[model samples]
Target: MARMPSFLKPPKKIAKRQLELRAQLWPDLNEGDLWSRHTHDGFSTIPSTMALIMSIMDDLSKNKPVSSTYLELWNRSFDEGFATLAKAREIAFHSGFSSERAERTWKDRLKILHNLEFINLQSGASGPASYALILNPYKVIQKHHERKTRGMREDKYNALVARAIELGDISLRPADPSPPPTPMAPPAAPFTFPLPAGSAVPPSPAAVPSAPVPPTGVPTSESSKV
Candidate 1:
């Protein structure tokens, strides 16, 4: 029987999961979204650091349950659009995040996801940590680029690694797509407040009485003294 060398130990299940999560979370990281200056900062500096943030964002995007502690932050400050924190938590607590640091983990991951446009940051007194889940732009660009560049006869991709020369670096960031149009709701039907039946409508501004005059023969001087 052959024994495994201590130097080449078997990898943990979490490592594979973490990698899978990252691939799903950020298929194409955009230059615009990357915090180059702050990239080296915090726990995210770990090799798979950005993946963790993407996992958290992915969880939120799926409309899953979240830690109540973190949900409290959104309830008081962040907007999740239609779904409340409590409602989200019910789905989340049942789905996963049963661990202790579940809440703190979310808070930390969200901090790294700060540049996401729809996420609102809470500053000043009684601050709460929360983020709004929006569509990831990086993934969209990759799909579009692939569609346009597909079927090209680029022989370099299959050439020997040592001899292969690649073209310009692909850009992850794309121009912000225009937001969806919000329905106008027909101007709310002009908000007509019903008047009592058979009652005469009040006079228009033109017919309303003008400013009143002082009583005839009233002495302004004597009135002021009294």
Candidate 2:
């Protein structure tokens, strides 16, 4: 078997640094759970953060990094594929972000590619060089096509909309006075003594009245006289 590189070897210091960086990155990550999973019983002071970093690193090293959003969209059979930067720019413009901010957000993701050593630093093109997720080579090609398909074609989209209306593909717009949903019928009036079919809600029995007992011991005055 070939020997592994020393730099790539897991070092105690690097492991600590990895944990520190991750803590800074995501403070909410459960440190105890992560440490227990990676290290046995937190006995080792070395940062368990490296364990998490290496998990992602191992995936990349194995050439099994997950798919990029752009690539995933290309694989879908939707008539409209993924968006290009140009289309994204239009969306950002409509969404009220400055062009520069939108572009910067995109370019920043390219730093991950540089970190992974996938692209040369000198490449004049500035976009995401690599994606966090692994994608098949065929899918990468498909993504390129998808981006092209999503190019800015306002005229074409408008024409398609008109055609759809003519073909009765679109529904008529409701009147402005359309009533609300009737408040969901007030939750079916709750279960007011509602019993299932054939199961009569047994009527509450009436209170029994005390019977009047005649005075048995004492005879009437007339009877006594007789």
Number of the predicted model whose TM-score against the real structure is largest: 1
Candidate 1 wrongly placed segments (more than 4 Å): 1-95, 115-118, 122-127, 130-136, 139-226
What is the TM-score (0 to 1) of candidate 1? 0.22
Per-residue lDDT tens digits of candidate 2, residues 1-226?
6565576467989789998998899989875655342344323222223232223332343343322322322322133322233344443344334656764443443343334433223322324332133223222222323354333244433443454456454322223886767654545656676678899677899999997665988877668898
Best-fitting candidate, scored by lDDT: 1
Off by over 4 Å in 2: 1-150, 171-178, 183-226
Clashing residue pairs, backbone N/CA/C < 3 A, model 2: 65-133, 65-134, 66-133, 66-134, 67-133, 67-134
Candidate 1, lDDT over the whole model: 0.41
